[model samples]
Each structure stands twice: as C-alpha cells, then as structure tokens.
Target: MTSLLRISTLITTLSFSGLAVATDVVHFEGKASNTLPEAVANFSEYNDKLEAVMEGELTPEAMSEVHQLSYTLENAIAKMSKELDSLAETLEEVHLASESADTETVSEQGAAYLETSRELVE
Candidate 1:
C-alpha cells in the first residue's frame, strides 16, 4: 500500500510538472536545416557543363538533348533554393509567435506551469 501510494504521488507530481512547458511540435521553422547553397552550387555546375556540351565546347552535340536536360536541372535547383529560404523565414516567424504568447502567471501552480511551458518550448 505504501509503495502504491508513493508511485501515485510520483505520477501526480510528474503530470502536474509536465503541463507547464508544453512544446508545440510544429516548430514553424520547417525544413530550415535543408542545405540550399550546396544544392544550388551543384546545379550551377551541371548548367555550365550542359552549356559547354551544347556549345560544342564539349564536342558540341548537334542535337544538344543532354544539354537541354542539364538546363532543366539548373532551373530546378534555383527554384528549390528559393523555396528553402522562404521556408526558413516562415519557421522563424512561427517560433516568434509561440514565444510571444502570454503564458506567465504568479501563483505556485502558475509558476510551475510557466516553467514547464518554457521548458517544453525550449
């Protein structure tokens, strides 16, 4: 009975403690970690290669089918880089929104809740 009571107390403490720092999983900074510059650089190289090949600098193909394909890849890279930048900014905004929300209070429960909430956000 004592052990049961102790376990109950521990669970209660943890549950109450957990309510303060609730982290929203959608951190709004979605996919900011995806490297864009590296990708753009690689595609730039592909575009250059395609240009050289098409121009006959690389034995300039009369048809330039491959060169055209490379051109497409370069455009795609540029588009992807722009998208990544936009996404990173969007996430920053979301993080700011979450931080700016009014959650602090003064009572013991409120303080505990505030700490927990901050922890969850952090």
Candidate 2:
C-alpha cells in the first residue's frame, strides 16, 4: 500500500516538473528573440569587413600580381608535360626489352626441365 502511494506521488511530481521546464523554455526563447536584432547587426558589421578583405577590395594591385603568377605557372606546367613525353618514350623501350628477356628465360627453364627429367629416368 505504501509503495502504491509513493508511485502515484512520484508521477504527480514529474508532471508538474515537466510543465515548469516548458514554461522556462518559453521565457528564455522570448528573451532571446528580443535581443536577436542587436546581435544580428553586430554580426553584420563583422561579416562586411571580412567580405571586403577576402574579396580583395583591400588592394587592387594584388590581383594583377596573382594573374602574373598564374600565367607563369601555366607555362611551367606545359614545359613539364613536354619533358614527360620524352621520358615516356624512353620507358616504353625499357618495357619491351624486359618482356623479351622474360620470354628467353621461360624458354631456358623449359629446356632445363626436359634435360633433368631424362636424366632422372636413366
């Protein structure tokens, strides 16, 4: 009987506690809404300064220097590509030689296997 009474009391306490928590949440949300506009203005000012710097509105000459560097990099890449083509031709010759050597080795191994088998039979 005491356990049953204690359980009911606990349930009642929990129901009231949930209502109290919900009311507090609403109050805090209202407070936040009241202050949000000032916060947004402050953030807007900070963001505008950041945008100006990142968009290079801070220096006109920086973009020209960037353009020159980009051109140089493109030329360098073209030169390197030409050199790699020559290297690829040389590597292709080496690959063919290695394939020929492999074929010769396989033939020698086959001949040696026949000779060993004949000797074992004798």
Candidate 3:
C-alpha cells in the first residue's frame, strides 16, 4: 500500500512538472517574440559603428572602442544563431508531434517555433 501511494504521488508530481514546463515555454515564446528583431537592429548599428571606426584614424581610444563594438556585434550574432537553432528544433518537434497526431504538443511547439522564427526574421 505504501509503495502504491508513493508511485501515485510520483506520477502526479511528474505530470505537474511537465505541465509547468509547457507553460513556461509559452512565456519564453512571448519574450522571444521581440528578442530577434532587437538583436538584428543592434547588430546593424554596432557593425556600422565598427566600420566607421575602422575607416577612420587608429588612436588608442578609437582602437579600444572598435574592439568593444566588435565584441558586442559578435555577441548579437551568437544570440541570433542560438535563437535560430532553438526555432529549428521546435519546428522539428512540431512536425513530429503532428505526424504522431499529438495536437496539444504540436500546438505548443508550433507556438514556440513561431515566436523564435519571428525573432529571427526582420
């Protein structure tokens, strides 16, 4: 009896945990909705600033600023890449879920994919 109770409790806990993760994905989707476009804009601005610095004179302070701007641009590009990768994974999951006729999972993954895709595109 005790073992049975423990098993049931464990199952319930695991079920709730899955639900929480699903809900959190939706929240992340909302946040990701704006992240991609902002990263792109920042990347462009940083690239332009870096270019101007490179084309101009090469003083110590200018070199320092250029390095900083280059670092910032690299970070932005990395972030965009990560978001794109995540979007790709979510799309694959959505496709698999649909193929398996798991509508709920497909919807959740689809929403996540859409959010990430929107962020990646201009």
Instruction: Give the lDDT of residue 4 in candidate 1.
Output: 100
C-alpha lDDT of all candidate models, in order? 0.52, 0.48, 0.76
* Model 2 steric clash pairs: none
lDDT of 3 by residue, 1-122 (tens): 99999999999999999999667521111112236787787787888888888898999778767756766676677778887787788899999999999999998989888876776566
Q: List TM-score per model, in order.
A: 0.31, 0.34, 0.55
RMSD of 2: 28.1
Against the correct fold, how does model 2 do in TM-score? 0.34
Off by over 4 Å in 1: 1-65, 102-122
* Order of quality (TM-score): 3, 2, 1
Candidate 2: segments with Cα more than 4 A from true spot: 1-58, 102-122
- Residue clash pairs of candidate 1: 20-116, 20-117, 21-116, 21-117, 28-91, 29-91, 56-60
lDDT for model 3: 0.76
lDDT of 2 at 93: 49
Candidate 3 runs further than 4 Å off = 1-35, 55-62
Predicted structure with the largest TM-score when compared to the true one:
3
Error of 2 at 3 (Å): 85
